[model samples]
Target chain A: MANTHISYTALPGRSRPYFGVLYLVELVFTFGLLAIGERTRLYLGPDHLLVLRRRFFTETAHRFYFSDIQAITVQRTTNAVTANAVLFLLCALTLGVLGLYPFSGGMILLGDFSFGEELLLILACAGFGLGLALNILLGPACVTELITAVSREPLPCLSRWGTAQRALALLVPRIETAQGVPSPEFLNVQPVLAAYATPAGRLITQPPITHDSGRLHELLFGLYLLMSVSCMIDLTGNWMIKNAFDSLLFMIVLVLSCIALLRQRHSDIPSDIRSLTGFALGFSVLLFYFTRPFTMLHMFWNMPENFDPAILMSSMLNPDDPLYVAYVGTQLAVDLFVGLLGLLGIYRFRRLYRLAQHNAALDTPPPPASNVEEPPAAP
Target chain B: MSTALTAWSGTACPRCGREMERLPSNSVEPRVCPHCKTSFIALLFPAAVQNEFLGRYGEPLREESEAACFYHADKRAETACDRCGRFLCALCAIDTQDKRYCPQCLENGIRSGELPEFQSAYPRHDLLALAVACIPLMLAIPILLIVLPWATDIALGFALGLLLFPAFVTAPASLYLALRFRKTVTHPLGRRAGWFPLTVLLAAGQMVVWAVAIIVFTGSLFSEF
Candidate 1:
């Protein structure tokens, strides 16, 4: 009923750029991968909201009409974000000061910091300082979601507190003009209205669908197993045929993990499992991207005069090579920790899912027992 | 058309769909989700409480002269479908009290995009053109520098002799894409402004860089000769 084709640019909302915490790292490492971060923009129209998301050379636009919108949910999420900022800032300051051991005139740190340690400390300081800057720039994190008749989605690039609030100030007025506020009496009578609308036989309630992510859990666990094992093998890795195989395996595992993550998005996976899986996936991708350039440049920098594949392999993976040992050792440690915990989570999830199934089956008539592989019973 | 499908009694967790502790309408304070511990402020509107009107049942025909419904032979015909002339009972009608159509006609209308109000998604090729104009050159430089080992040595001469292959290839394609989508409308709310020229300019910039590099290399070669 209202004019829908005018930009509401007069709304003085200062939206902060949000580079997703996990993705910010990926962007720095991979560089030019998918134009991530502040590329997601929200344009306010007179009667609709346009969320324009830019990814690489393509753009996706999601539009929501004001008249059709039913609710706006805003969640405060600053605690974790603030905590992370402080942690990064403190770590940066500490590591940076430690790196200044030579310049400190033997005053700050009692023990000697080796050249390698100094280099690592400085890099760590830079990394943490970058993290601190990004966190501050991201502003106080908040999740604001828009719910219409058909879909409920978070507003892209409106994660900051000040921005979302100002945007809402602009939005609520337009929405109010479109949809008038109901009487208090009318608001209280919703339950009675729903009761009256339903026909007699058609109103019978159906059992809620069970949240079964058993197969997905098992699949992810299997991939993690492969990833951990590959990492272990790479601990002593040469640039052999097997190293290529391991690379292929890691690629496969990453792809499958992404698939699993997508599938488990709307499912009722526990929060702990979801958080841990997300972290592990993000860390692995970050590590992969960060290490790849150095490895390439290292190989080219030390290119043999009489180039031979065998000689290159030996040089790249020489027992005395600190680079190989350090990278592989770090990878192994992370893989072992996350992979084992994830496996435990999978086992626990499967056991719980089975228990739920078993309980749900109790209400129905017992079926004849079949020779299926029984999983280890939950304690 | 009806608000019943959109309505829910209490707020559900956005992360996990468990029903959270209910708060008063437009409460300033946040309610933390019991399961996930995510704090939320739900601004419930009047639509949440609005009653839905269900479809009316078709009346049974009592007289012989009464027009029979196409779907239900025993019921009296309520109205004719707008798209097709088939008689429809009250139950068989699609859409709100607005446009009247049979189920088949409504389905066809949605799929054919004849009803623009029902369609929300349409791609913007003009935006794609601009993105194509700039992204490739940025991606090419860092990767080529490292992989080819040509940042600062004698290899720098060789690197200069050969302009970035990605930029050379993409420049023409970007220009073509820009020109093709030059007249396409991008933003619905904004005034008609052309960004294709900007895209063309970016492509031209890449071309100029490639030209400069080529000229320098050729000049160096000719001077050496």
Candidate 2:
């Protein structure tokens, strides 16, 4: 795959300096958020931290509002990032403690083990980790890139022009303002009728247009927002108990990076890349979700009798205790549910990307009546 | 009348049906087609032509003729003749089933078939080549007898022959024919008998070696006792 990494730096309307600043701010804040969320979860033990993580989704759902506020408030605010970063760091530390589990395999204290075996095992783990990360990142990038490429090209993106957009525009002239009018040149109202004319001598018109896009978009964005929030909650709650601030910070940064993805709405981001990223992000969250239960069951519960939980615990909460089992099971169920929801989010993102292309096509201007007329007799 | 002509020639929109002031001919700015009032993009082919390109380029035209076989006049073929366009009808076609073969497919198909009788006159001599390769394996028992002790010598004789016979006759022959002819050859006679020639030669050589090893080893054992 000869793939290009779409740089936000290349968008037409924006300047390089502005984008650079945004990137830096975005990255720092994102990292900080992840760190905080992770730390909080570690301290709070999956349950309490998850409640905090739900805020991110709520924040994302209200991003348009946040964007307006952020655009105004943070426009020149230089000092906010520092305070946020510090808080994020504290949370990340706590979350990190919770993020970590006793290493899944029992402690191997054999000092004289063969070099080859150790080397192979380490190599295997590193390879697996790298592959996991690649799947996490590359999948979404590929989809969005393809969507952008196809949309920017010459072919009309609409599934049906004559029957849908034209009919819709003609029947409900009022709705035309919302859909916006196509350029008159590409849409030859006269020829379209002539091409698929009825037996009647008069021009034929298709019935009123009905686009189900609004409901679809609402459904998708809603699902995505829900899933993302749930995952955030699950991670945060777990991290609060463990005190792993680093993991929390990483998740915070991840949420911020998603803002760049929302730029797809403003500019034409490729659908393939968006889908790929959605799948990757969704799947990574899913992996982390599955890993949590597996880690607790395999690593903590089965740890050597003498192993200390102090390094892993931000609080005195014992996950193996009967009191915590309900919490663990609840978190696991939520994680699974969100993992499934993320898949639905991916589907919605694809559906929306396609709809954007369609709307863009509908937005194209129609061709003139004279141009639609059969070219003057050849001779 | 003159202004209408000027407007049509210069600044008509292809999409939104809006007319615009005609700019200088050399201007690179994209204009809206006046009739449909659609704004066309710059640095791209027109939309209608682009759709045609996507749908039809490199696609087969309906006017293109279907391929026919050489031997079987009635049979319609899919692949074309490498040299000639003549349709080979069913009766005139060679059915190499996986691939359609015309009369000229010999050079490709020859190695896939067995060597002709005229080329190799010594039909039975072919068995000698099998014996030469098998002889070394058959003699493994005698060598083992000399290398090791008398007690295991007889058993080694049978083991060496059994392993050598199949490997020499079956694997090598099948592999060679597959590589050479590309087509698998089947014996019209007893299916195993065609290969049996090679196996028998190899087996006889192995038996001779085994008997010699047994006698030498057993006699030596008696002498030692």
Q: iRMS of every model, one decimal?
A: 7.9, 29.7
lDDT by residue (tens digit), candidate 2, A1-379: 0011211111111111221233333334342221122110101111110011112111100001101110000001112222222223323322332333223132322112233333433443454444334333322110000001112111111112222222222322222233333344533321111122222333323222122233333333444454445444554455553345535644753574365345433223333333433443444454455445534544443355566666444232444332234333433444344346544655665587688789999999998877787866877
Which residue window of length 10 is worst by lDDT in model 1 chain B?
A: B1-10
Instruction: Residues B1-225, candidate 1: write the lDDT tens digits.
Output: 111222344356644546654444454356778755666666666655444544488889989899988888998888999999899888777654478888888778766867645433444565566656655645554445443523455555444434466677778888998877666544433444466778799899989988998999999999999
For every prediction, compared with the true complex, DockQ reads 0.17, 0.01
lDDT of each: 0.61, 0.33
Query: What lDDT score goes with residue B150 in model 2?
Result: 29
Weakest lDDT window of 10 consecutive positions for candidate 2 chain A? A66-75
C-alpha displacement of A363 in model 2, angstroms? 10
Off by over 4 Å in 1: A1-5, A9-67, A74-132, A139-144, A159-166, A173-277, A288-293, A296-300, A303-379, B1-8, B11-21, B54-125, B128-149, B152-186, B200-225
* Model 2 spans > 4 angstroms off: A1-121, A128-221, A235-269, A272-278, A281-379, B1-225
lDDT of 2 by residue, B133-217 (tens): 4444434544453334323656675656654555545445533433443222321111222444454554555556556777998
Question: How close is every model to the real structure, measured as TM-score?
Answer: 0.55, 0.24
